[model samples]
Target: MEHRVSLITVGARDVETLAAFYEALGWTRVDSPDGVIAFDLLGQSLGIYPLAALADEIGVPESDLGHGAMALSHNVREKADVAPLLDRAQAAGGRLLKPAQDVFWGGHHGYFADPEGHIWEVAWNPFSALGPRGEFQWNGVG
Candidate 1:
């Protein structure tokens, strides 16, 4: 019951394709044990596994592996990076969900969906401070 997440695994319709997409974004991936692909993030690991495999491991039918209303995000160091990040996502076979724009909170952000329809928000929040390696911290500022 620690307040830390060790890993996050998503059901990818095509693990190979998803892995390729991430590699295209310059992410280095480590081969997974079976039916999965793993990428080491800052403080966690992102795992991509086949939907059917994940469902079977959970004793659920593949049909139950449905998409949910949520977004995974990556915060950037500068506002200028938002657009290029979105563009990179698109080039990597992702779809642009929202064009980069200035936000009321004084940030720049955009949204994109991976080939499996998992939404990701790329943002540059001026008020919040990121760690040395681009880890986000809620600065409690406007």
Candidate 2:
């Protein structure tokens, strides 16, 4: 088993709606016909599949699995962008969990939960480096 995650597939109750939500956040679907929509996140892939179908494909029962204990994070270049992105998330059917604020770690960040209860953190760290794709390069600072 490799100690790396190549993909993160989210089981969405409404695939098309969820896809549109992420697309509004600047993610493009990778061309595919299986109805599995995907977005390239840095060098990794984030996929969205129908909930029941995903459970069937994985041979798992569709129950309250509590797999959303973790959150996905998006880091930005300027601290000023955090509030606007949080607002966008809210406008796209996501629930705001936290308002953008300065963290004890010295960064500005906030949280939102998608329609399917997937938590996401949008942050802006002054000491971090951003790639062309808006992905972060850790700067080893608090």
Candidate 3:
């Protein structure tokens, strides 16, 4: 399998609400077929779908799908940009889970949870500066 991810889908209890939350975050929606709301990121697309439908398709109960154990990260180009972006998230209906602070790994970061409770980490990693188009690499862009 390729090492890159092409898409990330979130099963939401209310698709419209979750979609709106993302849209409020200044993400423009990409044209997708019915039942899925999609936003095209730098290298991948994020899709939001109905949680119950997702569970049914996977042949599992909705309760079996967990929401809190993982986090999606958004990396910034500078340390100073972290807190403001986190503030923007809060203004857009997301709950601030952690105020921005310097981490032991030498990064400045914070966390926020979307309306559906999906955790997101906003960070500025000096070791992994983003590309010109904002694509992220583990050890800085070549």
Instruction: List TM-scores for all candidates, in order.
Output: 0.94, 0.86, 0.95
Question: lDDT tens string, model 3, 42-133?
Answer: 88999998999889989999999978599999999999999999999999889999999999999999999999999999999999999999
Pick the winner on lDDT between candidates 1 and 2: 1
> Which segments of candidate 3 are over 4 A away from where they belong?
none
Score candidate 1 by lDDT.
0.89
* Candidate 1 per-residue lDDT over residues 16-135, each given as its tens digit: 999999898889989966867898998898999999889999999999889888899899988999999999999999999999999997899999999999999999988886888766
Candidate that would win on TM-score: 3
Candidate 2, residues 1-142, lDDT tens digits: the string is: 9655789999988888888899887778785788789998777899998898888887878775446579999887889999999999999889999999999988999999988889999998877868777656778332
| Number of colliding residue pairs in model 3 | 0
Model 2 alpha-carbon drift over 4 Å, by segment = 1-4, 140-142
Winner by lDDT between candidate 3 and candidate 2: 3
Among all candidates shown, the one with the greatest lDDT: 3
User: Each candidate's lDDT (Cα)?
Assistant: 0.89, 0.86, 0.91
